[model samples]
Target: MDVFEALYTTRAMRRVKEDPIPDNIIKSMIDSAIRAPSGSNRQNWKFLVVTDKNIREKLSNIYRETWDYYINSFLNSAKDPGASSLKKQNDKDIETIRRISNSASWLAENYHKVPLLVLALSRNDPTGSSIYPAIWNLMLAARGHGIGTCLTTVMSFETEKVFEVLNIPNDKGWTLNATITAGYPLGKWGVAERKPVDDVTYLNTWGNKTNWNLEQPLWNY
Candidate 1:
């Protein structure tokens, strides 16, 4: 797929089939990921691919606990129903929270069934700037390969436990930046609606409107 097509079509895929992803495919995705620019070319990224059934089951349990805590927090916040505006805002937030909680719960229950679990780790003292760009590249690359990936930080909530369980070395400074659960997708993917660029971009000064028109194609035909 073209860059634009991949950018537009890639979405967070939480649900995937149980089929295993080939090691060659996983390698290709990682190859694309490492090409992403990093701070001072430090290239301090490590990936841990977990396929062991026992470890997956243990992580799933932790994920479920974290998801439950998130749901309880959302419910507690929505319990206070006072003014109309307050109610509307809270209701919207509650709805989004509920959807995320449900999706996470599904993953928690079924993570063991996924083909691969990838943990992207960073150095103990990374530049703190280039990390996310590298992650974005990985997700986009996975999308291009017809593989679905979800960038989750749920495992970070139980980092110490994860480290202990996985036997990750402490001195390695192996902090989990993101966890990607990957497999073949069960359905189609599409672009999510975004705010108009005019609302966010400025030409030269803050608050000044950008003159460029995204509606028009970049190259004149």
Candidate 2:
């Protein structure tokens, strides 16, 4: 696939068919992932691809636990009048948020049924800035292969339980950064719509907008 095509369409794909991914495709995605630059060339990251049924089942329990904790926490916080960071959500925002939440809840309930789960671990990265680029590469590579992937961090809170389940060394240095679920997509793939690049991007000065007056993407498929 063209790189730009992959970039534009590689949104978080939570819904996927329960088809098994081949080993070679998984390998290629990892290869593309490792090619991504890490902080100072110290590639202190490990990608654990979990395909075993038993392991995925155990991890799924932990994942659902953590996901429930997160959702409840968010809901509880949203109910608070003074302490919540959530703004007054419009109808559109509420719809989008609930749609995403439903899909994510579905994934948590059916995590083990999915074909592949990739756990990204990092050593000595505090800000998580060094590791996420590599994870993004894995997702983008999956997009190139016509595979769907969702990058999730809800499992990070259950890192200890995850290490116990997966037999990862429970060392002080290792931190679970993210989990990626992958399989052939059950839904159609297309370019993701988002706020225009100009809206988020700024000129040399922070408040300055580019006078480029663009509405649509310059390139057509």
Candidate 3:
């Protein structure tokens, strides 16, 4: 697959088939991930490719609880329903969120059924500036191989439980960055819609307009 194609179409593909991904393919994904740059070239990252049934089941329960807690927190903080323009925009967002939440719930319930669950860990990188690039590289590599992946941090809420379940050393230095679910996609691939680059990019300084009037993506799949 093309690099740009992978970048654009690799959305959070939570819904995936239960077929097992080949070991060679999983190895290749990690091999591609490590090539990504790290902070000061420390290269302090570890990936735990979890395929065991019992461990995955335990992790799934923790993930489900965290996901529910996250969604409930959002619900509790949501604004009151109203007929104003802001409320209308929020309603639209909420609708989309509900759809995504449904998919997330599905994943939580059947996480163990998916083929691969890769947990990324890092040491001393508080901002995760180094680890996330490599994690994204792993996802992009999976996309190149026609595998779907979803990078989720909800499991981090139960850090101690995860460590115990995975037999990870209870060292404060090593932190759980994210858990990525991987399998063949049950959904079709398509370009993800996002705000145009021109709207977000600045010419030289902060708040300085670029004056680029791009209303659509410059490239096509």
The whole-model C-alpha lDDT of candidate 3 against the native structure comes to: 0.88
Clashes of 1: 0
- Preferred candidate (lDDT higher): 2 or 3: 3
TM-score of 3: 0.91
TM-score of each model, paired residue for residue: 0.83, 0.92, 0.91
Candidates 1 and 3 compared: the better one by lDDT is 3
Q: Select the stronger candidate by lDDT from 1 and 2.
A: 2
lDDT of 2 at 6: 86
Which 10 residues in a row give candidate 2 its minimum summed lDDT?
82-91
Clashes of 3: 0
- Output the better candidate (1/3) by TM-score: 3
Give one digit per residue, the lDDT tens place, for model 3 in 79-173: 54544553344667777778788998899888879889999999988787799999999999999999999999988888999999988998658
CA shift at 131, candidate 1, in angstroms? Answer: 2.3
Query: What's the TM for model 1?
Result: 0.83
lDDT of 1: 0.77
RMSD of 1: 4.1
lDDT of each: 0.77, 0.87, 0.88
Indicate the worst ten consecutive residues by lDDT in candidate 1.
212-221
Can you rank all candidates by TM-score, best first? 2, 3, 1
Model 1 agreement with the true structure over 170-214: per-residue lDDT tens digits: 776778888888889987887644556777799789999985666
Tens digits of lDDT, candidate 2, 48-149: 999898898998899999998998676555555674355444567656767788989999899888889999999977777788889999999999899999
